[model samples]
Target: MSTKTVRVLALVAFLASALVPAAGWAQQTLRIGELAGLTGGIAPYGVQIHNARLIAIDEINAKGGISVGGQKYKLDLVALDAGAPGEAVKVFERLLTVEKVTLILDGIYSSVEYALGPVLKSKKALLIWSGGNDPATTVGVPNAFRNHFDGGAPFMKVNELFLKKMGVKRVATYGQTGHADFKRFVEEYLPKIQGIEVVATEWHPFGEKDFFPVLTKLKGLKPDALIVHGFFTDGITMLKQAREIGLYPGPLWLNQYGAAPLMMDEASRAIWEGTYEILKSSWGVTTEAPERSRKFFQAYVKKFGERGFGAWAESGYDSVYILARAIEKAGVVDDPAKIGAAMQALNVPDVPELLMPYKPGKLFDKDRQAYPKIIVSQWKNGTFVPVFSDFGQ
Candidate 1:
């Protein structure tokens, strides 16, 4: 062949080789299922979690995948949208039986977690999820593990501090009637605070947009603080309507969930300003936050163009790394029992890829639930800033 022809052929051969995996060193595929509410009422938070899962899987695969038994295995994520409990159960079964996904990253939605219990037990698959603050759902489950906030005592303590800081006396409660966790946070936990009396309580359906009538009733009750328990969209709608109807100036707003940056995205800064909240993660508010969190936030913004990326979605990202580390520790790629054991016994310091802060010793306690460090964050001038943290004290 002529020299020019040989040069062109060699260049084409180089490009083809680079496109294919190296012989004998090619990475194997390990499939992970991601269950989230990509549609319906919970879509706002679900999309964020899904995005984070994608980022984590991409980063891991880029770093030559997970090393197990001296072999490289890259993650293949299969995401499904199960916005409700009935749908979630079906999706959970599909992920196990059809998709054959033994490992899953479940986004926050406690009712769905409860519904998936029997299936998880039967399939013996590993489910690392967010939410399920109730100990009953998390404590004794064998295959189920939580990588999110503990809403029992730790969350209550932070809310108590928030109440004290706001000088809240009589509080009115409002939340979504559909979500068990959100309803319980407003009905069960808010009433438990010693000094504050739950003066008036009202609940709206999952997708209610107009809150004028309820706001009117709440305003007449004259509460010192109002507890809003819905997600960012509905939460913003309720607060904005409250301001329009002249109820906001009367009651100090206390968000039952974390103060998400998404709230500011949905509504203006002036709408949620001065709102007291129990922050799930101190990603932006604290200096001690994990370095990966800062990098992850930047990556998310670069990929998704920054609507309102919050730390709440970091659990999904952490779940991916947590499982990868477990696979490494177990020395096997496909065994669920060994992998689950490794995850349960995971030491936080060992997994530097984690974005959320975990309590010392292990990621999960005896209950198989990880307790995230709490921060009392409030909407200041234009951002959510930390006021108190349970980090050192």
Candidate 2:
């Protein structure tokens, strides 16, 4: 062949190589990191939330991966068990530095959320909080989005209701000391309510088996109502001991954390028969929620028995679906800024699966901060029921 013809052949070969795409360049994988407390005082909540997330992911993947800007990307969930602050920090560091996840979905508890806030913000990761109700979680972190209502909001409403509607003048507050958010709910919101006087306030360690001492002190005060905040185990123990010691049941028992459905099953029906609980709407109830909530409730019950629609499970399932919606709306998973903006823009016309009915135009605020609507639920006749809501009945 002539020299010119040989050079032409070489040029053609180079062009063909450049035109061919690399082996792994067809699709990009989007990873979502989850740091849940799977082993601790709140392990049951962590387990249920994790299960809900898995269900959401499975449903989404079954229908095919999320679509972004005309391209489909499969969700890669990296779940880590970080039950305490020390473990949570390590997991956050790994997710940020090693896995390099652009989105983080975890932090069921306030302490873990607060501890992971700085790292997530510094890394510019979109942190979707499932259970951090502390106002401090949203204080300065623009990247952090808490789906759960602020812990103070429920307590504030309950305080007002008890003092104004229920005609309760004096009340005693009890909460778990180890949980920072619950403690702050007592310190900040409980003290601010008018009309109702806090005659006494007590704090117990997270795993305190004996509540007789605290119950003794609370009974002596003889307050009109008792506001108790603790896990299901502790709450059950407190109620059982309170009844066993012949503590007068004249004072109404008001529980903030005991609103979980599992608590009803764990505690005797007689104990919770007439007890008033201020909580999020029950996942089992569909009368107040939208069609999606009803569908999810039925499906969960069908799959996992009647006890599937607990608070933790609902919150967990909602978190994943909301994140998927945000990602779809954003149209770009590579950019955290875009995803964060999309998350703020999400507004569902009806309640999504396993979520309460968010008030109209009350999901996210002007500053991209979430203002969640809350409902007060009561346990009546061995079932969870929505009694009151800040938005409407």
Candidate 3:
């Protein structure tokens, strides 16, 4: 581990040892584990999500922690900087078998989740990711939950707004090929479309700045539109390059871009003038988010400034609250199956409990994945104009 990770782990160890109740009190300590990229390329995401988790923990602990059965418990976080995919597997194993944590949060990458899902399910430890929306992520894993599943309703809504409404016929898509969720989405969701055909599809590494050759090849296909799915930063860079090479093929649609205003610049923002982007919608800075969302946004801004809060920030916050609510409602935190049922039962719209938008009357699907519609925004000049909000699947 790096010095930073060591420091974080040391702090976690200290908290685990020191934060306990009186010997006679009816209070227990709940330990939650996190394995995310803290010192790598996705470090910003790790920091944003980890801090958001801390905010939720603080909020719950301030209310006398979680009440289970007939006792109260204080929350404690044990985090590790899961640097690479192999490291994520190691950390996940350590968290479960050694530290013996019941619930683990913030496996940010679909890659890590894909690798760890079977083991986590078998071990009966609950693992949740705030991001990873691909349908394949949930495929046989019963103990895992994703806070966003854009592949369902939010995804179709984008198709309706673009392919059907705008009448886009042929299209091209580009993303990080090595990404598990991206590949799964292409395999599962692409062929299901009725009216449109994907004329071209390209994949590259995450930070591949030279999209010239890729765009050049794609430009030759003469597709009606282009769909860009990947990191928001990559989307911004790809859009800029596509504009520079004069490969303006229909409207650009962005997915999983947790970044809106933070990733925009004068040069890149100019290129997205007519692009359409979809996201979790509840955490969007482009629209009028919930009142509590504003409060959460302001808190993050006050501490970490306004630049680093990705789309995952609100989901990270909501994930903790959801798990805590389930733990409290089930009256136990050790049983993962009961906790999963409690999570499913979070069907009512308790507005104050969420910093992100929940469905009008529900929480999770039958698979225990989040179900929320996406927001469609069109870039107009320097700002994003909300063209439509489709809550229907």
Candidate with maximal lDDT: 1
lDDT of each: 0.76, 0.70, 0.71
lDDT of 2 at 349: 49
The predicted structure with the larger TM-score, 1 or 3, is: 1
Writing each residue's lDDT as its tens digit, candidate 2 over 279-378 gives 4534344235566666665666666665524666667777887788888887777778887888887776422543654556646655444544566665
How do the residues 1-393 of candidate 1 rate in per-residue lDDT, one tens digit apiece? 999999999999999999987766667889988887678766666777788889988999999899987679989999888868888888888998899888888875777888888778777688887643554567566988887777666776677776877798998888777656655666677677789898888888766878999899888899998877766667777888988888876777777655466534544657787786664754653444456677787898899867756656787788888888988999987778889999888999878878776777778888888877777677776576767767322
Query: RMSD (Cα, Å) of candidate 1?
Result: 5.5
Q: Which rank order by lDDT, best down to worst? A: 1, 3, 2
lDDT of 1 at 323: 85
Write model 3 residue lDDT over 40-104, tens digit each, in one string: 65665667788778888887898899888778889998988876777788888888888888788
Judged by whole-model lDDT over C-alpha atoms, candidate 2 comes out at 0.70
Structural similarity to truth (TM-score) of each candidate: 0.87, 0.85, 0.84
Between candidates 1 and 2, the lDDT winner: 1
